[model samples]
Target: MASDSPVYLLLGATGGIGSEVAHRLADDGAQLVLGARSEDDLDDLAAATGGDAMPLDATEFEQVQAAVSHATDTYGGLDGVVNFVGSVLLKPAHLTSIDEYRTQIEKNLDTAFNTVKAAGRPMMRSGGSIVLMASAVSRTGLKNHEAIAAAKGGVTGLMRAAAATYSGRGIRVNAVAPGLIGGGENFASQMSEQILSSEAGRKQSEKMHALGRVGTPEDVAPAVTWLLDPETDWVTGQVIGVDGGLGTVRPG
Candidate 1:
């Protein structure tokens, strides 16, 4: 029941979850500005969803700023922004290289930081909602998830502080922490290949979730869209888990 045709700027729009969010928002009567690293991919998505597409590298502040400015200018103003940029590094801290650690920080924490800073600047005068992607690992201790956990943990902290700083200005900032979402072309594909390649491995992963299964991009898009919707104007600074109980429950 979304109205007003709110304008939303979406980063990582070509990714699995981001694509789903774009389609969901479009169906909700949203006007979307989609950003991603590949112009062709963005173009395809834009064509499919009737959204505007731009090439963006979220880690770069200037590019992010440009994308935000474009959205604001094109739509007259921006009503929301969703950042889907992130990376997954599942190596032990001792085994992770400095470069890998830096990459993780840049992809997760830096992407979120730059998106907030750039989007916040424009949305400052006219308040809007901002949704960021966090991970269940940020709150749960998972083996070999040291690097990504640390990075997404920073994202959670950033979301909270930004929410607090902007709430009074009518800006709402929140995050969605997802567990192992399969059927996506992302870093998780590597883990999915290993964890879902065998029947036994698949069962082991399914048992990790109370729901007895992993998630999909479709399962996550609704929560993100809800956060962006006007009805949730009162909710901010919250980290919601769309993890099928993976972060909270232990199957006995």
Candidate 2:
């Protein structure tokens, strides 16, 4: 008989990246707790994947706590938590408002904070994977990405710090910094705009990477799965870039 599959808690399951990750994990035979602000979206994802679904507002602490409890209570334990909730606020930094700044920070960074906190209890008890989504722009400068860059940079920092803090407890924390992943709702419109606006825009963006194309959710999900696998027990405190050679390029 096959071994019982471990369960994973997937936040932001309604999102393009999060949904892709959820499907990939499900295909690999993981039971899941799918959470998002939209009950409709979560319900649809859960039905499609045969996973448990819960409506969660990552911005609300009580909601996150409740969601985590539901997952643990339902599954007996959670083997991983993917903090894939984030925002990409693109605009001139000076044009950004105090409210916008706060909202951006809360939307992108605080969700991770609360999710990690709420999930840590079950994760520590069982020794599991904790994956946070960072971004290549956290370390690289891109126009109109100041707010998001700052928020995601905090995520990278949290990954390293949490990895160090939680290692002894058997909870491994890691991050994936992806550059220009296509087919996600977050970037679909912008990507389409950029791709169709001009041949020069497409060429310039592609030339920025050695791989000559943008990445996809599938391109990034494997690394996450590997990191969470028992095979990678020795790997921790690492941030892998799924940036399609973008990080390795030199400006000439």
Candidate 3:
């Protein structure tokens, strides 16, 4: 059975989906330790959710370890962890620069690796859950998404391996792969002005999903929360798509 108040460490707590998940977890009676690269953002979220805040750079193993340590120390124990650290690079393979490829790997894959390694130690002692973020593009071919797909693909692979290795220790690992989510200000910033401003471009992107619309941060938060909950203990090593059928279906 799940604890009445599960202690969870949430990385990238300031992002669109992360923020939404933080709030939902808090409402669901989870004690949260919020982490992000920006101290100001962490402080703000900490205040809003009544959670402790830690400055974290998920790409660095030591920082990831420290954040996990802080969560366990502050809350007496850690029950779950959710990582929302990732980037989007809309460029074809040939057009993608070396730097862009490296950035995507560091932002998406490195963060997942560090989070799993650090969190696994404490979580192994007491059964817990870990959730990482992937993307629909990892399983589906999308134009101008080579770099992001590669990085998120690595994330999916990492999550599955970690889940298999640690299940014996009572650790459950899973991932949520979402489609293009709308209403993310930071995500919008990553897009070209033309894509953001063009009505045709926006409509085309929406039509890619079987739902006939883009997703939102709200669309993903519930799934993350469910995976973290102890009630879903039987589920692990799965890459559940909260992608509005984007990965499995094509709208005619």
Give per-residue CA lDDT, model 2, range 38-152, as digits (tens).
7877898999888888887888988888887877777787788887777667677999987888887897789878877887777787688888888877867878878888898
Q: Candidates' TM-scores?
A: 0.94, 0.89, 0.94
Model 3 clashing residue pairs (backbone): none
Q: What is candidate 1's lDDT per residue for 128-227, written digit by digit as tens?
A: 8999999888978989988899999999999999999998889999999998878866534544566676789778878888898988888888999999
Clashing residue pairs in candidate 1, if any? none
The candidate maximizing lDDT is 1
Q: Which stretches of candidate 1 lie over 4 Å from their true place?
A: 1-4, 184-194, 197-200
Supply the global lDDT for candidate 2: 0.79
lDDT of 2 at 80: 84
